[model samples]
Target: MFTLDQTLARDCAVVGDLPLCRLLLMNDSQYPWLILVPRQDGLREICQLDDDQQAKLMNESNLVSHILLQEFGAEKLNVAALGNMVPQLHLHHIARYAGDPAWPKPVWGALPPKPYSADALEERLARLQRSLAAVGSPLSFPA
Candidate 1:
């Protein structure tokens, strides 16, 4: 069965879920990012999904991409499912801009991840949860 890596489990906050994927918010304030993890256990590849589930995951990913673009004014959206380090099945959705801290470069390993201050974290989580709700996402997160 697929279980989240302990590091990821501790770092990400549950944001919401589509039919086939669970959405999570990465805790780093360095980037506005999300992770989508398919619910099917032990899935390690896109081909592991049945055709319908595959379609659902794609649809949900696209929907999230759109929201991040429109609401967050993201100049670019980086979508990836690389499992080199963390072997669990998860997709990353990172909102990027031309002037962001690591602009023109990938967010990964650009700099040390900055953990949010308590108040900052609370504010960001609330903003993100509200935005997701406005987009018809039914998920609410604890602060």
Candidate 2:
């Protein structure tokens, strides 16, 4: 019943899944960005989820944020749930550094996305998969 939006699927690589969300890694090599999309249909906002689902989403979001920060030594962790272009309830967790290209400003629309090359993408995915596997919680990596 849950299907990913075309734009999201095209732009991100499947990292894995949590109990309630599908984890995706944005292909852009600029920043370590992860997206958590709830596995539900016709859900366009976080408020649409019940209290329990909301709590689970929050937990998963925090886990991804912390992972990004700790693994990347990020100066800041930015989390947002914006569905302006794609009407799916997806939360973005981006690791930010003080000297990053989009420092002092949001990553969106600041500069063009520098997508990872084939080898780089595969390596990044493997690294993320390993990281997610170590979390050892509600987070589940696909076989």
Candidate 3:
């Protein structure tokens, strides 16, 4: 059975599930970041996905990138699937702004992760859900 990596489970909010991937919201409040993890066990690279699965992952990732950019008025969308630490098949889509703390640099290790407050987390998740809904995504979010 598929399971989330311990670090991921501890650090992210379960936003929902698509047919083949679980949508996750990174808890860091600094940026609008989301992750998509394929619900397949022991897969640590995108190349491991079969052709159809690879296509689906890209499609989903693009959909998420566009939504985040619009919702956050991002100056750029940073999409990546680097699993150097966790070794899980997960894609990250981060919305970046020119004036953000990280600015021209990558978000990682720019500063310590600032977790969202309970109320803020809830609100951010709602906004993400609404964005997904607006795009007519079929994923089902937690109530």
The Cα local distance difference test for each model comes to: 0.80, 0.89, 0.90
Q: TM-score for candidate 1, please give it.
A: 0.87
lDDT of 2 at 141: 62
TM-score, one value per model: 0.87, 0.94, 0.95
Could you tell me the lDDT of residue 94 within candidate 3? 92
True-structure RMSD for candidate 3: 1.4
Winner on TM-score (1 vs 2): 2
- Per-residue lDDT value at 91 in model 2: 95
- RMSD for each of the candidates: 2.4, 1.4, 1.4
**Residues 55-138, candidate 1, lDDT per residue (tens digit)?**
988988897798789878988999999988787788999999888899898888898888878787777767777777777865
Tell me, by TM-score, which candidate is best.
3
**Strongest candidate by lDDT:** 3
Candidates, ranked, lDDT: 3, 2, 1
* Candidate 2 vs 3: which has more lDDT: 3
- Of 1 and 3, which scores higher on lDDT? 3
Q: What TM-score would you give candidate 2 relative to the actual structure?
A: 0.94
By TM-score rank, best first, the candidates go 3, 2, 1
For candidate 3, write residues 1-143 as lDDT tens digits. 88899999999999898777999999999999999999999999999999999999989998888888788888899999999889989999999988888989999889888999999999998888888888899887545
Model 2 — which ten-residue stretch has the worst lDDT? Answer: 134-143
Off by over 4 Å in 2: 138-143
lDDT, residue 20, model 1:
73
